[model samples]
Target: MGTIELLMQGFAVALSPESIMFALIGAILGTLIGALPGLGPANGVAILIPLAFSLGLSPTSSLILLTSVYAGAMYGGRISSILLNIPGDEPAMMTCLDGYPMALKGKAAEALATSAIASFIGSFIATIGLVILAPILAKFALKFGPAEYFALFALAFATLGGITGKNQFKTLIAAALGLMIATVGIDISSGVQRFTYNSLHLFEGIDFLIAIVGLFAISELFFFLEQHAGDGLKKVALNKLKLTAKDILFVMPASLRGALLGFVSGVLPGAGASLGSFVSYTLEKKVSDKGTFGKGDPRGVAAPEAGNNGAASGALVPMLTLGVPGSGTTAVLLAMLISLNVNPGPMLFQQSPDLVWGVIAALFVGNLVLLLLNIPMVGVFVKLLSIPPKYLMPIVTLIASVGIFSITGSAIDLYFMVGFGIMGYVLRKVEIPLVPVILGMLLGPEMEKNLRHALVLSDGDWTVLWSSGLSIGLWAVAAAGLILPMVFGSILRGKMKRSKDGLVD
Candidate 1:
């Protein structure tokens, strides 16, 4: 089918009551989860994976549901950042720089309205990019060999810079741990037990959904308690959430710039929404002093919100085309596709055009739902900030427990979930990043498969792994991701110091 024909069919499905209901459910649930300091799209999708299974949703509907949550969470993240001075998720962290300050200045409603509009613009533009670019990228990826795929996975891990925390050693360690854990089950090549340990659960290894739920959702309780985050909450007074005509006019260009920037960044495997938002915020910070960006500028609100949402859409590009996820959430979505027995790659468009276009169509609806639902209802989401930590934390833990049990159907799975939660808590205490761990877990086995395939194709020739131009280019990118970030960071720090010195002089 042609792209337009497939999209039309997809829209017919998406506009149906069942698909629309699921989209709405995902959007509402995602907003609630994203507004929490503990959960975001990854956790929301992981926690709800079992729901998709239990409901026996079609591949198209299930994807629409999950992707809607993904899109909604990107916008919903701004709520807690603006109201509580707490980032609802990683991408929202940048929003807090200006959003909370705006709230402090009695402009909370205006800040939130700007955030919603910017998020819509970013998401809408990036969805258009997805529609236009995904098929082309997929066609390009069709020519990839095992060696190129292996190198691309390497590049994926290496390019995951800002989202994986600052300490490179720690990020590598977390990734290494994931790779090791992924090897726990019996080896397919040799038919030999690796880490099964005679346990039935070990026979299949830990499911990524179980691991993600424990690591992200349950682990948050520990942090909340340790930091005493619930007490002495900041109260934000909000009026009607609406942007003035002047405010709208001022932020349109900034939103456009952020959307373009974010879409480009998010196309890189593993870069994710946090990097998009950080880059957008930094660019706006340097643009001009007209609004004093750090001191509650509306343009500041527009930039990161647009970038993060744009990145959210852009992150799907690699996943849909190359079968490699750019962010943790997309990793979960990839896992979802796998569960539906649909492989995402260059052939996905040909093999599953209905599913592919259905998902794209759903994104359009989801973005619209986010804008319409969030803008006027910003006050409703803000009220959640006042929920007492004591009351809220336990309920979250309970929900996590229930969700895990629902999916696994095993008490042993609960045990593993609890164990991982403890591990997650310890890792977070030491400032280790969780995103790389997820990437490693998701991509590690794929990497092993590609490496083995490349060797087999070359008859055990190691140099064959770097034989092709594509593979060499991917390796070069991997090398650059490892080295260039540090150089750029140092340069940025020096510039900041010089600017401060000039101000003093």
Candidate 2:
């Protein structure tokens, strides 16, 4: 069928009564989960996996629901970040740089409104890109072999390192940690346990869902406890919550630029929403006339919000088209796809055109709904943040634990969950970036498998690592990721020092 015909089929599926109900439920629940400090789309989806299965939802229906949740959570994150200075997720951190300041200035409603509109714009733009470019990218990715896949993974790792900037080292460290976690199960190639330590449960390996929930949701509970409790929410006037036409017109250019930049960065490995927000903020700083960027420029709020949402949408491109996720959240999405017996890759388009197109189409609808939901209901979301931390954290923990237990029905998984939660909390206290550990865990097996296969095919020839031109190119890029960032940091420091000495020329 032609693309248009295929999309029509997808619309029929997405607009079905059951799918619509599921989408609405997901959007509402996702917004609630994401509005809670530290609970993000990844965790939200992980926690809901068992629930989806309990409902016996079709794979397509489940995906639509989850995707809606993803979209809503992305929107919901801004609410807490802007109002309470507590970022709902890592990507929302950038939003807090100026967002909280605006809230403190009694512009909480305005900031939320602006962020909502920008999010809508960014998501819609990226969804359009997904619709148009998905098939083409899928066709190209179909050409990949094992070697090419390895090279692509390497490129993703390197790109993530570069895109993460100052925290790149921590990102790598996190990725390495993840790889180590992934090594715990039995070695399929050898049919012997590797990190099982002779435990019966270890033979199956650490469950990614358990690990993700512990790392994000459970760890966040500890942080929530440590902070001075009580709700940090502030009441804002409803009349003041609406955005002026001038406000929209003022931020239009910045939001558009940020959306475009975010989409491109999101498509690259490791870039994700955080890098997208960072780049968009930098560009806004360079271009905007307002000197109050750090204080509370509307543009500041608009840029990162737009960029991150765009990046979130953009991150899906590689996940669907290449079967390689660029971030932790996308990794979870990938695992979900695998569990659903849906293989995401080039052939996905041909094999499940309706599924793919339905998702893409739903994104368009979800963003529209989010914009409408957020603008009038900004007050409601802000009120959600008003729940006392003590009450909220316990409930969140209960949801997380119940969701996890339901998945495997294993007490052992619960133990792992708690243990990893402690580990995640400890790691966060040391100022490490959590993203890298996830990257390592998710990609480690693939990397090892490809490396082994390449060597075996080359008869244990060590030089085989550099045999393919693509392989060589990827390694070179990885080398650059290590070297160039340092050089750039030094150059930036020198320029700053020179400027301070009044030697600008």
Candidate 3:
């Protein structure tokens, strides 16, 4: 059968009453889980895996439900980022850079609405891409070896100076500190502990989720206590609650660009939504910023939202086509599929066309459901800003505390979280950007592992790093990333200033 006929049959299955019902339930549940700080999509899907089995859901029905949740969680992650400056997940961290700034500027409603639209656009496009390009992208992703992966990570780190557009020295310090922290665990290549301090808890190294919660959520709590400020907690303006046509038009190009970048990133195993978001925000800041990107520009909110959601959808490509999970959440989904005896690979399309295409169709449906569900709730989410700090701070603390403890069940991790929170507070006090620290922590280990693996494979020949055309291209991009920022940073700022002053068109 042709692709269109298979897709149409899959839609027939996905549109069944039972499938639609499961999709709705999954979408709502996933959104709630995602809105809670720290409990991201992976946990959400994992939590429901047992339930699917207990209920004896068919393979198609269970897959549809879980995949819907995955999509919904991606959409919901922006909520905490925009309202509270706490990312609901790692991928949402970039959203907090500008989304919270928009909230502080009393444009919280606009930011939320704009993000919802951009997310829809991104997921819609990525789902279409998945439908058309899954096999081809899977094959392309196989071309990335250890050297290419290392260079890709290098490109990510090289972009940080431009992403933050802050003090390069301070950013380097923060990133270095993160890399140092990542080295605390036992070395995979050597099995020797580096900085565990003879403690059992440190053996596994710091969990990035715990670090993220502490750094963003707990630190924000400290800031709240210090300021005790309720001045910015006014009710959202109803007049600005809805998105204008100009606002839609203004963010459309950035969203499109971000979605494309995010989809490509997601296609590559290990690149994931975090990189998609980081790259999208960095590129948008370069391409379209008028000095307002990190200061609450709607494009800033739109770009990352689109990027992350696009990556979320695109991550399924490798999972379904090659049986290689592209992101962490998809890893969990992979295990679930294995448990259900559904072997995903090139043969999955031919052997279980009904199950495979049903899930894809459900993803398309779930995107629509999320878009419809999120837009009407913007006013509700914006009301979070009106809550006084005295009452709200404790709730934030409680949520972060509970979420972390529930995930790790380790008191030491909680203490570590508090320590990281203090560290984050102190870093912010010195005018240091926190995103680079998180970025380093996220990518440092992978970068090191890939570099080591490449060296081992090449028998310590360093030239292997640049031998492949892909690796060489990535190296060139990394070099350009480091150099172009320094060259264009001042020029862009100058142009933005002139534009603001009516001296430039």
Candidate 4:
């Protein structure tokens, strides 16, 4: 079938009454949570995962809601940034520089309108990119052998340093710590308990969800408690709601460039939406003569919104093609797929055409929904800011705890969650990146499984690691992923020094 025909078939599935309902619910909830500070796509997914499970949501339905939530959250993040000067997450930080400035100038409605339109453009562009690129990538992925798979994992692991905080060494150490934690259960291949300490519960190994909840969800709660002392909350005005034609014209080029930049960045393993936004912002500044970029330049609002939305879609590329996530949020989605027994990778398109196509089709529909939802409901969403923190935080905390507790009904899980929350708080304070820990936990088991399988097949022949050209190429990529960052950084630094000297002269 032609691409258009196939997409139409997929849309038929997405637009069904049930799917549409769930999509709308997902979008609404996603926007609600994402607009709140400290609650981002990753955390929002984690918090709601248990609820999704409890509802016995179908895998497709569940994913539609979750992914819609992801898309919606990306749209809603700008709401917080533009109005309160507080980013809903790291990715939205750049949006705040221009978004808030627009709001301060009583252009809140225009700022939101531009952001919404930019989000639609980015999402639509990325969805089209996915439709065209995903199949090709998946076709090539079918050629990968076990060695190549092992090398791909290694490359993803090596790239962790680039995404983490200033202390790359510490990030590596934290990642190693997570891997070690993964070893606590009985080894599946050898049937030997590696680090269980003889506990029956440990025999099954630490649950990935539990660990993630502790590391991120719990950590965030503690951080919230600390920041609770601050008085930064501000009400957003909802009087104006239109973007001028000139405003649209001004931001069009930047949004397109940002979408492309964001997609490329998101396709790289470990570089999440935050990096995409940062790159797009820098690119726009370099290309445009706008002095108000960080001061509410409409392009500033458009660029990051476009970049983040495109990055969100682009991150799906690696997950669908390689079964590896390019970011923490994708890692969570990957876990969701596994839990549903839906194995991703090149074979996925063939194995689950309905799911894959449905997801792709839903992206297009979801973007349209967000565009409609964002513009008309601007007042309602803005009103959400009025719900006082005293009331809001408690409800959020209660909902999160209740949702998580519903998953396994294990009080112990709750304890682990709180522990991780405290750990997350400390990690945030120390500026140790939490994402690497989650990424490590998610990939550690897969990496080990692939490595052991390859080793067994090779019968102790270490040289078999490089037996395939694909494996060698992957190893090369892995090596470059590690080394190229330093080379690039040095080059950029030298150019900066030269520019400074020229300015002085």
**Who wins the lDDT comparison?**
1
lDDT of each: 0.81, 0.78, 0.78, 0.79
**Native-referenced Cα lDDT, model 1:** 0.81
Give the deviation of candidate 2 from the true structure as CA RMSD: 4.4
Write one digit per residue (lDDT tens) for candidate 2, span 1-505.
6778878888788777777777778888888878877778877876677577656677788888888888889889988777767778867777887787787778888888889989888888888777777788988777665666777777767666544444556666777788888899889899888878899998878877678778777888898889837665655454476578999999999899989998987887656787687678778888994668767788988998889899989989988998778665777777677767887889999998878988877777778777878888777776777678888778878887887787788888999999988998998888676656666676678778988887788888878777778667767876776666566755643543342242111
Query: Ten consecutive residues with minimal summed lDDT in candidate 3?
Result: 496-505
Tell me, by TM-score, which candidate is best.
1
TM-score of each: 0.92, 0.88, 0.61, 0.92
Once superposed on the true structure, which residue ranges of model 3 sit more than 4 Å away at CA? 1-119, 130-135, 162-169, 236-363, 493-505
For model 1, how does the per-residue alpha-carbon lDDT over 368-482 read when each residue is reduced to its tens digit? 9888899777777767767777787787778767766776678998888888889888898898877677777777888999999999989999999899999999999899988
lDDT winner between 1 and 3, please give it.
Answer: 1
Q: In candidate 4, which residue ranges exceed 4 Å CA deviation?
A: 1-5, 229-232, 290-292, 486-505
How much does candidate 4 score in TM-score?
0.92
Question: Against the correct fold, how does model 3 do in TM-score?
Answer: 0.61
Q: Which digits, one per residue and each the tens of the lDDT, describe model 4 over residues 1-505?
A: 6667777878988999988888888888888878888788888777667677778888888888888999988988888888877788778877877787778778889988999999888888988898888888999998887778889888887777555523556676777777887787888888999877897767888776776766766666666667664453666566556667887998999899989888887888767787788778778888884565666689988888899889999999999988888777787888778777888899998888778888889888888999999988977887776665656666656766776777778787788777777777777788777777776776788888888888899897877778898888888888887776656645544543353232211
- Regions of model 1 farther than 4 Å from truth: 229-235, 489-505
State each model's C-alpha RMSD to the native.
3.2, 4.4, 8.2, 3.8
Task: Provide the global lDDT of candidate 2 against the true structure.
Answer: 0.78
